[model samples]
Target: MLAVLASVFVISMSGALMPGPMFATVLAKSYKSPWAGAQVSLGHAVVEVPLILLIYFGAATILENDITHLILGIVGGGMIIWMGLGMLRARKAYAGGTKDTPYNAFTAGIILSAGNPFFIIWWATVGALLVLKIADYGLGGLTALVLTHWAVDLIWLSIVSGLVYKTHRLWAPALHEAVFVACGLLLMGFGGWFVVSGVLAIG
Candidate 1:
């Protein structure tokens, strides 16, 4: 049980640590309102709650479906690339110090999160492994799983928000632009890899 929890914690932390649209929005919001940034993080977490449950509960059948994995891998890869390019393009606008609208920030976080294929892949694969492994422990195991994931998200998001709040000057428009550009490239490279791999498998 301890081992299971540790594994889930590590996976959760890794995913949260990745700089995606959600992370970027949190940082941007931190510049304006830390509470709001937290709220945004909460909103993303709320979505994950259901997503995680669904993936865990369906792991057995879901993993058996080759076509499902193929589609997920392909879509996930494409989404990452799209987001990466978008982030790169937004660098200029971000560096210019544009004000963030509450609606825009919230919407951006939710949309990016919803469209994120990496989240789907992670939950479907690593998430499935943990949930299934601990399923024998019943509700207690399930609770631990959820809690660990939530804890990882809470800690990481708070850190991200805090960084922006505490170091807004250091995280000027230029810094934001640079961060996005770097994240974007990472996403693109990884996403492209997934897409290509999926295609080869299908072929």
Candidate 2:
């Protein structure tokens, strides 16, 4: 059981630590609030709760559909690109540290989690495996599985946002602009990739 839980943690962290739309969203928002990560984590949970239930109900088959991936790729890709543009436009807007971002951390979390096709796909494949492995132990195991998986997200996001918050606390305008630009570009790149892949797949 310990081994199962431990493996889940490790696998969860591997995904959480990867640079993706969600990570970019967190980075884009951390400029204004150090607690963005926690807020985002809550938002992530909002989506995840339903996802966990879906896994229990064997929803992976639906998520694995090629048409499903293509549709999500297009729709989600557009949203991510829009988000990246927002970031780029707001790159310097947060310098004063008083205004709120267009999308709050929580909303960004929800949107990114929902919009990122890879996220859904991961849940379908890797997430399903983790849940099934632990679900065999019954309710307690299932509970641990959810908590452990989310815990990894929470811890990693908090640390990242916290560090960014602290760094920006010094009000390094140059660093702020540079990082936001980089993050914005990164998101745009990922968005483009998703769209292109989807298009190619469809063709």
Candidate 3:
């Protein structure tokens, strides 16, 4: 059980550290509110919790189906591409220092996460495997795995948000815009990869 928890923490943190849609969203929102990352993580948990439960209840088979993966890949990839374009357009607004429309950070988190095919795929594979291992120790192990995974997300995202908030003034506008553009590009790249992978899988 101890090993399971430790492994979960390490793996979860590794995923969290990667630059994904959620990470990009956190960086964009962090400039406005230090709590943005936590809010986003909470929203992410909203989707994750249910999915985890589903996996625990033996819904892994559905996730593993090639057809299901193809559908998720197409839909999720399209959504991610749309988000990336939105972020690019928002770069001007960000540079102009215009206040963004009132929105719920938590909800944004959930949407970004739900739209990410990689996130779903990870849970279907790596996450499912972890769950199976933890299942050996019964419910207690499962509980530990889930909690540890979420805790890592919360801590890491909070730190990132706080850091961005604190350092907002230090970065030049051009530098900030550049960073945003880079994040947007990374997202688009991932989105394209997902689409291609899905197509290949279907073929």
Candidate 4:
């Protein structure tokens, strides 16, 4: 059990530390509020909880379907690429002192997450495997896995958001722009990969 929990923690952390739409959203939100990442993580939990349940209840088969993967990959990949471009555009607007309207960080989290096909794929594959391994221990194991994984996300994202908030004043505008640009590029790269994979699957 301890080993299971530890494994979940490590794997979850590895995912959380990856550069993706969620990370981009959190970084963007952190500029406005240090607690934004927490809100985002909570929103992430909203999607994740149901997903975990579905996997536990044998919904993994549906998620594993090639058609499902193809559709999600195409749609989600396009959305991610769009978001990346939006971020790039936002940088110029931000430099011009135009601020975006206030929105719920939680919602941003949900939207960003739901729009990422790679995220869905991960749960469908690697996450499903983990679920099977842990399901042997019953509901207790599932619960621990969910909670531990979420806790890791919350902790890591909170730290990132807090650092960005705290250091915003110390960082130059150019530095901020560069970070945003880098994130945007990474998102586009991921999006492109998803699209290519989807096409291959379809073929």
Give the TM-scores of the predictions, in the order they appear.
0.69, 0.92, 0.91, 0.89
Best by TM-score: 2
Instruction: For candidate 3, list the clashing residue pairs, or say none.
Output: none
How far is each candidate from the true structure, as Cα RMSD in Å? 3.8, 1.7, 1.9, 2.1
Instruction: Please give, for residues 66-142, the per-residue lDDT of candidate 4 as tens digits.
Output: 78768867887787677667777787554334664235678877766766666777898899988988999999999
Worst 10 residues of 3 by lDDT: 95-104
lDDT of 2 by residue, 40-112 (tens): 9999999997888788777878877778778877887888788888778877775555555677889978877
Candidate 3 lDDT at 189 equals: 78
Error of 4 at 110 (Å): 1.7
Candidate 3, which segments miss by more than 4 Å at Cα? 101-104
On lDDT, the leading prediction is 2
Name the regions of candidate 2 deviating beyond 4 angstroms.
none
- Any runs in candidate 4 off by more than 4 Å, and if so which? 95-97, 101-104
Taking the candidates one at a time, how many backbone clashes does each contain?
0, 0, 0, 0
Q: How close is candidate 1 to the true structure, as a TM-score?
A: 0.69
lDDT of each residue in 86-192, candidate 3, tens digit only: 77778768645585524457987877677666677789999999999888888787788888999999999999999998998799878888877876787677777
Better of 1 and 4 by lDDT: 4
